[model samples]
Target: MPSAEAPAAAAMDGEQRLHPWSWLFVLLQQLRQFVLPLVALLVFGGGGGREAQWQALAAAIAMVVLVAVSLLQFFTYRYRVGADGVTIRSGWLQRNLREIPFNRIHNVTLHQSLLHRVFGVAEVRLESAGGNKPEAQMRVLGLAAAQALEDVIRHGGSDRAGRTPDAAEPADVPLLALDTADVLRLGFISNRGMIVVAVAFSALWQIFPERVASRWVEQHAQQLLGYATSMHLGVLSTVAAVGSLITFGLLLTRVLSMLLALTQFHGFRLHEQPQRLTVERGLLARLRTSVSRRRIQSWTLQEGWLQRCLRRRNLRIDTAVAETGNRSDARALKELAPIATPDACDALIQHLLPHAQWPMPAWSPLSASMRWRLLLPTVLVLLVLSVPAWLQAGPWGLCIWLWLPWAIYGAWQQTRRAGYAVDTALVAVRGGWWARYWRFAEIDKLQALRLSHSPLDRRCGTASLWLDTAGASNMQPPLRIRFMPEVQAQALYRQLSAALAARRLRW
Candidate 1:
């Protein structure tokens, strides 16, 4: 296979074609989208007598249509490198054509699934600066061709016209490497352990009856918590038993998280180039992506209560490009460090933004009066709940009132965590209570500025400021500061305004 970056020979056509195996990828994808319905119909056909034949025929027709569609897709799809941009043309009826210029290409992800690896083909997903969908997705390209295409999109490809592709350059440097041990560590701290349990439980239910496990868990819960025990159980003993169960559950989750992490980041590598950063990881569905430094909109560091206890942090980068339809882009690009020590996390920040230094944020803390506003909302909810409780059991109904003190403590903790600061390089915000988090973005990347004031805020002489940017997703934080002192909020707004006006926007 010829590299897409090289100048094509006169005998060879400039237009590129996918591997013959792309037809299989298309068929598998199409089948996946309709497998559930197909199975349901087949089951229904088995249950019914005369109607079974018609149902089976309908399912067969659906399968044939799906296969035909995939075949047509493979036949019609075409992609080629041009002087101005990379072009992708597809669709027989709608006839969709997409061309993405070099500057518009924000990021490129090269992925290979189990089948893709077997066929020596890759999926090249190109994400642009602005859009909901991906710029183009070349589902099956040769490994070398995909690499060359990604490189051509990133750097200037026009200069390589009428020439062969070059080998690895000296500018590339190995920045980070994650071993099996590191991946195992990442799994424990990932905080995403329920997926496995849920899938397993669902599969069990589908295979057997729901009561198979649910009843057993209920019976065990009764036995362990003293409901069915012969010995007398005091309140403290019951509480301790429940707490122990919770601790065991948390430990199980951590173990599961670690196992899942090992699967996702089995062989992770971070590479640094002159203008771009590349990441390669995974054992099953491999991911290889490059994100340009110029497209980075912001950086965020998060520490959950469990993570905080372990002195671990999750770091993510917010880029200008779209997220490629699903979280594959986020899973690959947003995560700068999935799991690392605080010092290692700080080092990653420095490595990513070498021009910027970590300055002490001069925070304007939220005022004490802000608690009154926070408490009011909770008070109304308590009042509404108390009405129903009073109707049921008079004096005992007010027991829900005990939750007030806990709620107040939570609100106070939030007040302590809430603050905003701005420095020469980044704007910072600290918020959240049990799971406190800090969000930071570069000062020059401000997209929009908004100052909001309520009647209470006006009376308290405070306001809220929102900092909008292009890089917003589930992975990154919303850059908004609530309940800031009016004078300080206005001052920061003015500074950010000046910063925005002075520099040209990137996205």
Candidate 2:
């Protein structure tokens, strides 16, 4: 029988073929990509008749083709491990060859689903800087082989200090670890429950027949109306009943969110290595990924109202690796401390950026007119919307103006909370009232800087400054300071630009 390191040895000597079951994983992955359409077809394609027979025949043919393609790919794909790099060759007809140097690979990721674990196999992805896709991806390999490959690449494709690739080493220094209780806290503090609910609702809507949905709604509506008529419930009672139902729904969502957190973050741990940081997490589906210490481009500290109440905060990092377009892959690298105390967060930041002072003593406030500038858009929006409200509800519609006080209060809070801080080593922005964040990057890591003035800003004598960093996420707010004095904005931009020009980017 072949040993666990057999695959690694084979690759080092010549070329290696993936595990025998690689085709199954490839097939499952492809199927997952088109699951929604497949669900729709399965739900709606079974109407009886000659048309149904044709649909069934076509589906069978498609499945057979998918299976054949997966098999073909597994047979054709081949990779070799070399002293300086790795080489991959694939495609029987087209034929492609590629080589990736160990020094250029920025991210090394391993994923193991429950099935993969049961089969003692794992998936590996090697990502390079400034590419939209992974440099190389192996669908399935022996767990030991995967780790050995990671070790070889991390040590510049050579054994470390004359030891074998699979030799055990000193214990890793622990940076952070999450237990079940911490994961539960994170779930309660996250809004991922709502996202999960929305996705589940979409799936149900796609799968359920229109008639079934209509019937379910009709039955519930009739039942509610009959109960109300029979009880002759007062207005207050009706309101209480609706409120109770909403409360129950909210509790259910929280429970679901907790389950999600457990699945995604159970057994989470962060470890500090010689030149890289490693993250290991997940319950049934595991992930192990590493990023070089110097590859970190920026950092963010996020604290929501709930997190503050729980005395927890989230610390994330941005790296120079190109966007993978996979949320799971992004999460593997970004989440350094999913949930940690304020002190722990500070310690982590200090350890990573020892020169850049963590938790600067004071922050420079934005422009004096920042409050009104923020409120101007809200006022105009309310005014425009009130017209429709008046058209429909008469005097009651005018109550929409009641929202103005709340908007004004929010603007005031935002203005007070938002500020920027800078030093020779770092530039940072802090903002957001209810859900607050601190975003910062080293001076050398900044890619670009912009100073802009809107029409209103010009009239108000205010401007905004924006800083660009590598691998920024579209979902997160930019590192910006809005409604600052024009002079201050210009000075900050020039200072950062000068700093960027003077130092070389580490990543």
All candidates: CA RMSD (Å): 3.9, 2.9
TM agreement with the true structure for every prediction: 0.87, 0.93
Local distance difference test scores for all models:
0.76, 0.84
**Candidate 1: tens digits of C-alpha lDDT, residues 1-507:** 112243332322377887777778878876876765555445433567777778778877987887788778888898877766778889999998887787788788888888888888898888877687778777787776777677666664543453344543446677677888778877876676877788777765554445666887788888865653666767898789779889999899989888778767877877777688888888787888888888888777788887888888777778886555564555447676777777887887787778777633378787876676677678889999999999999999999989899889988888988887777777888888877777878877778899999887887687889887785644445778887779878988898899889887765
Residue 52 lDDT, candidate 2, scale 0-100: 87
* Clash pairs (backbone) in predicted model 1: 187-257, 187-258
List residue ranges in candidate 2 displaced over 4 A.
1-11, 160-170, 327-331, 473-475
Candidate whose TM-score is highest: 2
Model 1 TM-score (2 dp)? 0.87
Give candidate 1 regions above 4 Å deviation.
1-13, 43-46, 158-168, 199-249, 323-332, 359-361, 454-461, 473-476
For lDDT, the strongest prediction is 2
